[model samples]
Target: MPKNRYRNKEVKFFVTGHEMEMIDKKAAIAELDRSKYLRKMALEGYIIKQDFSQVEQLVYEVNKIGNNINQVARRANEVEYVSLDDIKYLKKQLEGIYGQIEKFYDGG
Candidate 1:
């Protein structure tokens, strides 16, 4: 075992069955043991819950844009020409998607 460096003080508490269940659920989601999770919360006062649904949605939107771009490319290849307005519209759509991603990063 490694030597302990900090103080040896201890704290104890009790909670109802419902509370313990909630604790277990939270710890499971964080993929942390109960003791470590509780210690982190006690020290940090709160935990930022992980939620990736927004990221998934963003990826979905990007995939849709890619599909649209592919279709436009296929049409242009078949016809051997692409209009200036179509190109400009595609550029504007890409810029709007970029702005949406920026807003997500900025937490706006």
Candidate 2:
């Protein structure tokens, strides 16, 4: 911890056990001690809360698409057969993922 150059004020608050646990978790993720984390959050006037469910779902879909492509490739290698429909479907899926990512970044 660095010495506070202008230590002239103090702030205090009370929180329940659950709230404290949440604070600890957030602070840990932010790589800051609890007091510093709270001070930065208080002064910054904004906090970013991420919902990763959509991202996780997107990753899952991408993985599935990749697996399908792999299977298609293996089949193509075994026999000289490749489906244009599957390639088109993969393109559409990728486009959908791109749109979803754009929406997410746009605060949808």
lDDT of each: 0.85, 0.86
lDDT of 2 by residue, 5-78 (tens): 57657788999999999999999999999999999999885867988988887788788878978988898898
**Candidate 1 C-alpha lDDT tens digits along 1-108:** 335947456778999999999999999999999988888889986668977777887888788889878988998999988888878878887898898789889886
The TM-score values for the models, in the order shown, are 0.54, 0.54
lDDT of 2: 0.86
Worst 10 residues of 2 by lDDT: 1-10
Please give the distance, in angstroms, between residue 15's alpha carbon in candidate 2 and its true position after superposition: 17
Scored by lDDT, the top model is 2
Model 2 residue 55 CA deviation in Å:
1.1
